[model samples]
Target: MTYCVGLLLETGIVMLSDTRTNAGFDNVACYRKMFVFETTGERVVAILTAGNLSVTQTVIAKLRQAIARDDPEHSIMRAPSMLDVAEIIGRTLNDVHVAVNERMERTKYSASASMLVAGQRLGGQLRLFLVYEEGNFIEATDDTPYLQIGEHKYGKPILDRVVTPETTIEVGRKAVLISMDSTMRSNLSVGMPLDLLTIRRGEYRVSTRERIEAGDPTFSAMSEAWGNALRDGFLSLPG
Candidate 1:
């Protein structure tokens, strides 16, 4: 299991994910669940994934191979629009998922994966989409400006309460870390070495990317500050 969260704010987009995958207690390892594709000034895309590692890796490798082949029909870089890129990834994920599941069927194993794609094309709207294991996807809207995958429940409350289009990039980053801290405290499957990233709108580049490890000073401070704030808020509440 893993955890990945994406925040769509007024200034830009923020995404974070853990690097752990586990088949059992003895089979734990680190694999990046976050993937990025960009052309510096022209376009930038980041994909945060969860579920079956095999499925996600293959799907990404196929996408990269297609791009390398200059196969315009299957290449995300050749996509005419961000929506088209989302569509291509959705189809690839769906196809790869089913194939992997079938291969693992004899062992009674299930392989599945989902990806969150966030990026913008030149002259196109900055958008975010959650593509499911089945190849279908839903876009983030003003009403729901965020999407989460893998162990999402514990961290959703803060996002629901405070995130919005008017949110600043700095605050958005804090919110995601707090959100991840909450999930980490609650679940054993999600661990440290989190990939935290930000893509400022209109820049077509990821302006900030952070690798937060256990006991990182900034993260430690944020976690402590959040705890203090909550305690104070609770104590000051009228009973």
Candidate 2:
């Protein structure tokens, strides 16, 4: 399992994903869950995936092939709008989910995966979508400016209390990092090394992209600070 979150705010979009995959206690490894496709100032799309590795990898590979071939009808970079891009991704994810599940039937394993789609096209509005296993998705709106997948429950409270459609891009990044920190602390399956990116509104390009490795000083410091703050807050609460 993994944890991925995307926030769509007035100023921009912030997304983060963990790089952990585990089949068992002894069979654990790191695999990036974020994929980005950008045409600099023309268009940009970032996908954060969570679920069966085979299904997610195949879906990403096909998406990349479409771009490499310049398939106008299918390439996300060529999609007329962010909505169209979400539709394309949804359809592809659904197809791959079904195909892979059939082959895994004998083992009773599921090939289902979900993804968060966030991006903007030149002159288009910034948009975010959470695509489900069935190929359908829901957009993030003002009432709920964020979407999360995988080991999400442990990390959701901070987002619920702090994030809003009007949140600043910098704050959004911090909130996501703290959220991921909380999830990693509570879940053994979700481990180190994280992918983070941000796209400013109207830029049509990624503004920041970073990978926070295990034991990075900055992240470790932030995590420790947050933990201390939480402890103090709990102690201050009335019994």
Most accurate candidate by TM-score = 2
lDDT of 1 by residue, 70-161 (tens): 89899998898999999999999999998988888899789878999999878988999999988889988888999999999999999899
Number of backbone-clashing residue pairs for each candidate, in the order shown? 0, 0
Cα-lDDT of candidate 1? 0.91
TM-score of each: 0.97, 0.98
RMSD of each: 1.1, 0.9
Best by lDDT: 2
For candidate 1, give the lDDT of residue 70: 86
lDDT of 2 by residue, 63-170 (tens): 999999999988998899999999999999999999988888889677779999999998899999999989999999999999999999999999999999989999
lDDT of 2: 0.95
- lDDT against the true structure, per candidate, is 0.91, 0.95
Error in Å for residue 16 of model 2 = 0.4
